[model samples]
Target: MRVGLTGGIASGKSTVSAILRDLGAVVVDADLIAREVVERGTPGLAAVVEAFGDQVLTPEGDLDRAALGAVVFADPDARRRLESIVHPLVHQRGAELEAAAPAGALVVHDIPLLAEGDRAGSFDEVVVVDVPTEVQVERMVRDRGWTREEAEARIAAQAGREERLAIATRVLDNTGTPEELRRAVEELHAELAARP
Candidate 1:
């Protein structure tokens, strides 16, 4: 079975994904593949340079992620242009990994932008990890060191909770401890496993 695990910023999708991994599902992470595609000598980096110019690169010749982030997040056109270069490569790599998984294996694809990108219905099932907006802000402050404005900006950029839940086959409420969260994953894993 193929399921997509998604949520807004600071919604604990990675934490839930770790639990799912422990339960024996093959997890394909799009962000990880994105990094792979843009490694030092890859063609992806070349495309990024062509699109955004060498100013986005570091003195060490690798991608200066902070610099690139500042550019795109400030300009929608810049972000879209970069996404045009990166998303296709990321999706292609995802398909390759999905194809290579053992037959009938349960796979969890963790895509952070599934809803905003119009990909919510692409999976056999969609699992949303949710928490209160305030708690999400707190996490962004504590875990990610994001300023309040920065956190709010990212939240504003994503699909709203109602939109995400409207498409979900299952919802993982993540307003509890790690142990409680793991229990949720275990329960969901068992439920999916029980499905014929």
Candidate 2:
């Protein structure tokens, strides 16, 4: 089964992904691939440099994510330009990873922007780690040390909670404790594993 795992920022999506990984699912992480594709000598980085210029690069010539993020997040056109350059490469790499998994393996694609990109149809199952928007904001403030405004802006950038839930084949509500979330994931894993 190919599963798309997604949730809003600080919605415990990574925690669920990690649980799935530990439970023997082959995970293709999009965020990691995104970073790798833009690493110093790759064509992705070269493309980014050409699009946004060297100001987005660090003194050591690496992609300065924060600098680039500031530019793209603040401008809709710039965000699209950056996405146009990166999204294809991410999909290509993600496909390659999925194809390489063992036959009959449960392959999970952990993509933060799954809903935003309308990728639910590509997966056999879309598992959304659901949480309220206010809870997400609180988690970001407490866990990630972001201000309320910063957390809100980041949340606003992604698909809304209702939007994500709409695409979910299964919803794992993560509003409670870590133990509760873990138990829910284990049950989900068992359910998926039992599929024919």
Best candidate, lDDT: 2
Number of clashing residue pairs in every model? 0, 0
Q: Whole-model lDDT, candidate 1?
A: 0.88
Angstrom error of the Cα, residue 133, model 2: value is: 0.7
Residue range 1-196, candidate 2, lDDT tens digits: 9999999999999999999999999999999999999999999999999999999999999999999989987887898899999999999999999999999999999999999896799899999999999999999999989999989988988899999999999999999999999999999999998896
TM per candidate comes to: 0.95, 0.98
Question: Which residue pairs clash within candidate 1?
Answer: none
Q: What is the TM-score of candidate 2?
A: 0.98
Off by over 4 Å in 2: none
What's model 1's lDDT at 32? 94
Clashing pairs in 2: none
Error of 1 at 34 (Å): 1.1
Q: Pairing residues by index, what is the TM-score of model 1?
A: 0.95
Judge candidate 2 at residue 74 and give its lDDT. 82
